[model samples]
Target chain A: MSRREQAKEENRARIRASAERIIRTEGIDKLTMRRLAEDAGVSLRTPYNLFGSKTDVLIALLEGAGFDPGDALALRDEQLVMEQLFATLDHIEAFFDSDEKFYREVYGGIMSSAHPDVRSTNVERVVAMCQELMTHAAAKNELQIDTNTRELGRYLGVQLLAVLGMWGAEFLSNQESIRQVRRAWCGILLQHCSNASHRAVDAAYQSVALTGS
Target chain B: MSRREQAKEENRARIRASAERIIRTEGIDKLTMRRLAEDAGVSLRTPYNLFGSKTDVLIALLEGAGFDPGDALALRDEQLVMEQLFATLDHIEAFFDSDEKFYREVYGGIMSSAHPDVRSTNVERVVAMCQELMTHAAAKNELQIDTNTRELGRYLGVQLLAVLGMWGAEFLSNQESIRQVRRAWCGILLQHCSNASHRAVDAAYQSVALTGS
Candidate 1:
């Protein structure tokens, strides 16, 4: 990149880092442009010039920190569907648990905004991740999938997002949310699966319970 | 009530009304204590004195305008479980659709807060409403619930709230969210019910399809 472009990118990163720190320490309500500019050691107008608004800065942070399911996708060939699903959930949980404050701040920021672009992009990412998992299940014949697995994937994605939101907001504890996910996946979702898939899911659930994960 | 207490109540109502108007017209991002005070024709600190915070005012608006479900509950003896469920949903949709902007603002406010008291109260209200519906369904033997109806009620309530949040955030259209709820109630939920209940649910689904709702 050119020197000017590189400088602009560096400036943007500094602003985002400052925004993240503010949100983690002071909550989303404190993530103002003035506070962000002061923390980043930039003029007040610099934030407006770079991000346009506080919501814009938040959207930029989320887009930058968003996770990719590449590793989870890689495990599809070697693992049972339930095992793969839980592993994916664990991966997701770890990402959020790594910085609970930051996750809560980002989630709160996303939920607070009425901007359709931001909201739709977040939901779309969840749908895409679940679709990858469902695609693997269909290829392995792990589920009967009477209806379109894509649609099922969408539903599952929404359910997980709801659980994540509940957990982030402290309406449900981490363990409680994980248990809810297990019940929905095993008790409810398995109903639509093949007999073999049902057996596999049941076995997986039992194994997890025995291991106390 | 004493005259002083009556005036205090009136002043509180005016502040709330002004908050609602500001949120509906300008969105939640524009809602500040200063703006609210000016709009309400009160002192700068009046909003903080009455509601404590912006979220507190928003929560009050939601609690005030939230659906009562009293009308649907009263129809317990006159309608099938599916009929009553849909009626309750219709009531909720009407309340939301009456002013989509206001509904979105209030919902966004509720979702963004991590305050345990507010989050728990919002969820508990949903659980209580759904439990009442489930109790009526059980009393009339409309469905045979294998698990605790309260647990089932909690799941249904959470699912509905998820849909409401999605709809308010514009991630899902009204029709699409309603269809999702219908699928959950009939397709997934009925699995835990009796065969006779399954037949009833299927019949209800078909009847609704025929009516093109």
Candidate 2:
């Protein structure tokens, strides 16, 4: 890579780190472009040029904070399709629980942003991750033949977002949020699973039900 | 009722009516307490005294717009449990579609409110409505004997809210939003349904899957 490109990457990373620090020390509301630029030791327009808007910066923060689907797939390579999906939920729970205040605030910023493109961009990323997994499961004959993997992925993606929304809204705790997503996953996948994979999915459902009570 | 009590009720109705008009004609952001007072011909403190906050006013607006769970139950008394649940989703879709701009703005207002109580109050009201229906389904042996109806209800309630969240966020169109919710409902209920209800639930699942594709 060229020196200029390397410098640009370094600047991006520094800005993101600065944004995270600001969120941690202050709050999402305080992490404006001017504030971020000053904290990161860059010009005022640097943040705007690097990131389109405040919403873009928050999306970058989320992506940097392990919101990438590719990373999620790589992290659970050893598990079965159903187990892998549950693991994804576990990963999300852990991520949110790791820093509840930070995530809640960041998520609030993203969801409440006036820019619809940013919201859909984030939702589509998660949906693609789910679709990739469902497509893999379908290739292995784990899911039912009639299952529209893409649609199911979209459904799961929206469900996960909803669960996260509930958590952000303080309607569900982190643990309960994961459990709720698990229950929905198991319940939805129960009908979509092939006979060969039904047992594992059912067991997961039973576990969620048992623990929920 | 005493004359004073009756007068207070009249003020509330008038204020709510004016609030809706402002939201419908202008937008949610323009329906402040002061503006509502002028529009409703009440004292500026009248809105505050009656509604507590702008969030409370939105909640009242939502309830007035047929968001009450009791009304949902009454609207589908003749349908079976499964049908009743689906009907409730349909009811929500119609309500939102009836005036997309108005409901979307109002929903955005409520969800983004600083007060968490109003959000939970709305969520709990929907959850209770779902639980009541699920309990009735269980009593009739329509659901599996060991199914946790309450948990299932909470799952469904949260799912519905998530779907609405997607709609409010403009991630899904109105029809697509309802389809997503129905698909989740059918998938989740497929496993918990009794033998007699299995065919019906499966049919619903197939319908959602087909429509979704």
Best by lDDT: 2
lDDT of 2 by residue, A36-56 (tens): 999999999988898889998
- Candidate 1 ranges beyond 4 A from true positions: A1-67, A73-75, A80-83, A94-102, A106-119, A139-146, A182-188, A201-213, B1-17, B42-66, B69-75, B79-83, B113-116, B132-146, B184-188, B200-213
lDDT of 2 at A201: 86
Encode model 1's per-residue lDDT on B1-213: one tens digit a residue. Answer: 999889878878998899888887887778888999999999988888888877788878866776565454454665576567766766766777787767776776766654657667777877787777776666666656444567666666766766666665667766666655555555435545555456656764443231211
lDDT of 2 at A210: 26
Tell me the lDDT of model 1 at A112.
55
CA lDDT for candidate 2:
0.81
Q: What DockQ does every candidate get?
A: 0.18, 0.45
- The structural similarity of chain B in model 1 to the true chain B, as TM-score, is 0.80
| Candidate 1: residue pairs that collide | none
For residues A1-213, what per-residue lDDT tens digits would candidate 1 score against the true structure?
A: 999989878889999999988887787778888999999999999889988778778868865786554455354466777577777777766776777667766766765564667557767877877767777777777767453677767766766766666675666655556655555555445455666577767764553331211
Query: What is the lDDT of every predicted structure here?
Result: 0.68, 0.81
Off by over 4 Å in 2: A1-10, A74-79, A210-213, B1-10, B74-79, B210-213
